[model samples]
Target: FLRAIGKARLITPLRSEGGHRRYSRYQLRIAARARELVDQGTPIEAACRIVVLEDQLEEAQRINAEYRRAAEQADPPPAD
Candidate 1:
């Protein structure tokens, strides 16, 4: 199913010297999420797409938070 997930673009595992797939901790987490979605009755393809979108949303939110913090630092409130 990892191959299927890779083909679906949910996770991209690295290849070992012998061409074996090697997943990082992050990728494993993605796989676990996919499994969770599947257990909830989501189709495999749909689960992969959801996971990818979820990861993208999380990254966007983190960046947005950082920007907000930096902006606050640059220009604090004018008065109490």
Candidate 2:
């Protein structure tokens, strides 16, 4: 998966006392986003740019709004 997104070099294996590789939450999120974008027809470089470089604060806000609306509609409160 790392190689597929051209991040084989960036992804490093973490060593624990037991010698197990550990990945941080942020790294996992980045990998997941990369896979998603790649599957959506975005080139690896462009996917990385959009997910990592481009400012996504506004896009995040819009997504949050949509999620909140969906949650509200999913189980609306009962009438008094």
Candidate with the greatest lDDT versus the true structure: 1
What is each predicted model's overall lDDT from 0 to 1?
0.93, 0.73
On a 0 to 1 TM-score scale, where does candidate 1 land against the true structure?
0.90
lDDT of 1 by residue, 15-70 (tens): 99999999999999999999899899999999998998999999999999999999
What is every candidate's alpha-carbon RMSD to the true fold?
Answer: 1.1, 7.2
- Give candidate 1 regions above 4 Å deviation: none
Error of 1 at 70 (Å): 0.8
**Predicted candidate 2 versus true structure: per-residue lDDT over 11-68, tens digit per residue:** 4656799987677786677778877988999877777777665337767888999999
C-alpha root-mean-square deviation, candidate 2: 7.2
Write down the worst ten-residue block by lDDT for model 1.
1-10
How close to the true structure is residue 74 of candidate 2, measured as C-alpha lDDT?
A: 100
Residue 80 shift from truth in candidate 1, angstroms: 2.9
> What TM-score fits each model?
0.90, 0.48
